[model samples]
Target: MKMKLAATAIAAACALPLQASADGEVNIYSYRQAYLLEPLLNAFQEETGIETNVVFAKKGLAERLEREGRNSPADLVMTVDISRINELVERDLVEGIENDTLQNNIPQNLRHPDGKWFALTTRGRLIYASKERVEEGEITTYEQLADEKWDDRICTRSGKHPYNIALFSSMIAHHGEEATEEWLEGLKDNLARKPQGGDRDQIKAIHAGECDIAIGNSYYYGNMLNDENQREAAESVRLVFPNADGRGTHINISGIALTKSAPNRDNAIRLMEFLSEPKAQQIYAEANTEYPANPSVKPSGMVAEWGEINPDDLSLQEIAENRSAAVKMVDRVDYDN
Candidate 1:
């Protein structure tokens, strides 16, 4: 609920006191790991001869930007979830982008209305069930997870998780508070264990026979498939695309935005445009196993193997608007209880 901005482009050349050069250099602050974003940045540098500098952290970059203020050296910000993006918007940290290429490449739902941020890649919140335990057709919809039959057979991360919270917000948007609360209560009763751990841990619990079903994002599945140690963790379970018959699967994104006070404004805009291009989108998909936000880009083989899915067409801003209500509802149902 704490709102802050990620990136701002400033006009002042002497803001940060760092050495400035017109050699086409851009600085980026990212919530994602360096390696995941390195390939694209490296490719951008390779293609445009722009020097790219990056600082990566899982949290606190917003506060860091706020502290740095006009003196902030950051020219661009990249992070996951609508909450973080909304924070940037609320704090007036990100600046409006005027690029036509970005506008054409990104769908309206995936970008800020003011053109401050745009989703680069997406992850879906889908069902993961034990292949040996749960029958293939036994569960399909997210609504069905609340059924009494699944009691003590479900595993999940904490409700406070941004992924779960966002999914919950989407549910609220689709289903009224009363219905969502009822579903949450049922889900809480069906929980195999109290919420804990990341998505991979939930899947690992399923493989361990600790639970028959779990909720997770698509990228974690990809990460598991790619990791030598956790490959076995994904082998015993099947991924299910829920709500295919209705609102479609709930989805979230890892996105980028230009800071309002960006020092290297032209370079930052160029980076935004570069990321929206098909090749960069493909690099994001192939490297991270995420679906490209650009509809023109095909998902990588790993994601394709997971099967095709229809994402909920709801706007990303709707998810941000409903996040607080979703968090309150989670607490009301004592989802962690």
Candidate 2:
């Protein structure tokens, strides 16, 4: 009942005209799902007496903001993936932040150098291997996914997906485009079936015996383990941190940024700082099954059980920069075909 009212309020608020510095309220346009933000927003409201109005969608918030320009009601933008947040800056839709609280909480590697964005939590791009088929220590690196031994044994989503693009971009960053293209072609040759579906679908394919290996985000495995219906499929596979012993696993983030037309700037900043703090960070970590960007806070127990992630130290900006080349390379190699 309480949740319904909150949803009602959020819907009503989203419909009204937005004004700057609307008393005791902050508005947001989020690509992140609403259910994930509800608890965190409610907690912030309870603590500060500031209401949060959110407009959630999977895409187009940036374009909407562009259309509204200065009249945009959004105070903040939150979403997953480096490319999405970088899109905001690339379009000049977000404001640069200079808060000590944000700077202190988020690591340099995880935040934009100019403060155009800050990562709140990170999820690893992991290799999920079939437990019954793939032996322990058999495959240890991202490079191994291209090995001839794994021919006709791999599954993955579309090469154009942001998660995979980031991983591919990282490859270009580390090994140069020529080598990365060769790797992509080899990986494509190894696919058991046409690349389709999200990360979870890749895992499902593995469980159904369509493939012996799949690429997925770490949190998907954790979420599946927690879901009764998905547990069996999830348990059929074991988590492997690709490149853990070398350049470390590729990671992506769920991040937030201040919008240029922040009506209630102060309240938005408060929410940002609150999220970066231990309490909210812990809540986010547990809720999403991601590692907290606030290094001081620990990951949820379920995530910690998976073993530590030795994250690639490569600059995320470099990855974002290489995104075009990565996508082009995906096309050039006919990765999805």
Candidate 3:
């Protein structure tokens, strides 16, 4: 019975591409905010005359896909975080895509080894320091966050956040667990307050003079600057690219993949290819203030304003592989305790 079900699903998928109308729509399960993605979807529809439908949720798209099984209507999945994308691949819910356009556009380190997913945008894990308190060049590396000088002067979001967890995982990838734990301890000792709030809140704390330095994704700075209410929250802090002379800046991505049991495989492939194109990539970068996955596409003005720095070039898979261990270490240190 299991064999028969698998055969039927494959047969359905094989038949889907051939039957998919040029004008057929694609349904997307997006973990990203809808406003950030709407413009690109609109452009895609304008170009292809194919409708684009999306279900936007902050979490659980993976479980949704798994539960829906072969009957799932989702053609594509879009999400942030390497671990989430890896989860889809591990569950056999994501299909491998091979396209010359994708290969030529996205760098190898940013894409999955099996072509299961492709990063669309990149965000640096950067430091934000109080302009009045921390002079330029005072903190130049991520390692400096552990220095005694920053004691009780640093703020950050919860370690449980995927962004921080991924950042910690990258540290483990570069440094051994012992060194990484020691660094975390130093950061903990330096905390202005127990980790609370989102990345923006950390910046708010910096603006309020509660902390002299904070860690956040570069795009959050852009987002805060773009928001009317949060503009005040970002006004006092300046962005810093850490480790510029060493391993390079740590980074992560917002990425997409095709669902393995997609009822609209052809539409899924088309959407993926479309996203890789320069126009779509630019829209993504501009809207989110993230570096485009396509090297040929330049970052938007806001991202460019942050200046260029070499990314660490770490394989995103390394972050995913170390995620569990990183979480364990966070608990071991009683990061919140």
Candidate 4:
């Protein structure tokens, strides 16, 4: 996706392309940037004739919703990370939406038990290892990241970031905090350097010979292949879906929810149902370089080439419950230092 908005243009416009509509409409407050979602939203409008309005921001949509209360124009909230979705639910900002289409389209583990939110796309947290130095079968599970055999060889971003927090939360969900704390300390001991930079930086570190292995989300690999500067660096590493033999690889989602005071409730439901269908899922996931939430819908482009993901079955809610504990563990180990 080539989105070339100048910084001034983006700062002034904020939300782009579509303007807020008066009728037969649904308004979206998205943490997902407009460039990443416009193609899919345009498709939704063309198919359903429902006018869609979006306000995209990097942060504070949740606070805005709370401030607006019943007067809010938001019909749906779409964003990355399960914690953000759960945060909306925790604040009573969104309503439970259980329908035949949503239930049938999303798997049981991905949707909330109360039906307040549903996952639209997923990305696996995988090990990206140097193809030349790291043998294919050298690592098989997330537990192995902490092993002394891999000492001073792993690279990753800050442990407190939501992506890593969610992953560590899953570890706490699967293993008690005591065991998780120990594993976290061990993993810290094995880091190639104090955890630093984003997922792309970890891959770049591998390419630059700073480390033999790095941890990153699945889509970054697909994205790297699209960039001329990062292509060779991306190719130097092989994607590994860890824990395939046991609990399965850790995974995260970008999801959607309906606001509690949606002015366009029926139209929003129509849009939600439409988005949950296989056709829309295919378009949406491919555009975002994500695994479609619907099991029957396959990922497209180079993402498909990464091979299939066997995601862990643990409830995302369980992971959310353990998130605070996970963050505390990270600080206790001083992983980011």
Q: TM-score for all predictions?
A: 0.93, 0.95, 0.92, 0.93
**Could you list the CA RMSD of all candidates, in the order they appear?**
5.3, 2.5, 6.8, 3.1
Q: After the best TM-score superposition of candidate 4, give how far the Cα of residue 63 lies from its true spot, in angstroms.
A: 1.2
lDDT of 4 by residue, 122-154 (tens): 999999999999999898889888899989899
> Global lDDT of each model?
0.85, 0.88, 0.84, 0.85
What is candidate 2's lDDT per residue for 1-337, written digit by digit as tens?
Answer: 1111222243443455455457888887788777888788888888888888766767777887887899887899998999999899899999998999999999998889998898999999999999999999999999999999999999999999999999999999999999999999999999999999999998899999999999999999998999999999999999999899998989999999999888888889999999999999999989999999999998769999887889887878789989999999999998888
- The list of candidate 2 runs beyond 4 A from truth reads 1-21
TM-score-superior candidate, 2 or 3: 2
Candidate 3 lDDT tens digits, 113-214:
889999999899999999999999999998889999898999988898899999999999999899999999998889889999988898999999899999
- Model 1, 288-336: lDDT tens digits are 8899999999886889887788999899998888988999999988898
Candidates sorted by lDDT, descending order? 2, 1, 4, 3
| TM match of model 2 to true structure | 0.95
Clashes of each: 13, 1, 0, 0
How are the candidates ranked when ordered by TM-score, highest leading?
2, 4, 1, 3
**lDDT head-to-head 1 vs 3, winner:** 1
| Candidate 3 residue pairs in clash (backbone atoms < 3 Å) | none
TM-score, prediction 1: 0.93
Best-performing candidate as measured by lDDT: 2
lDDT of 4: 0.85
| C-alpha positional error of residue 144 in candidate 2 after TM-score superposition, expressed in Å | 0.9
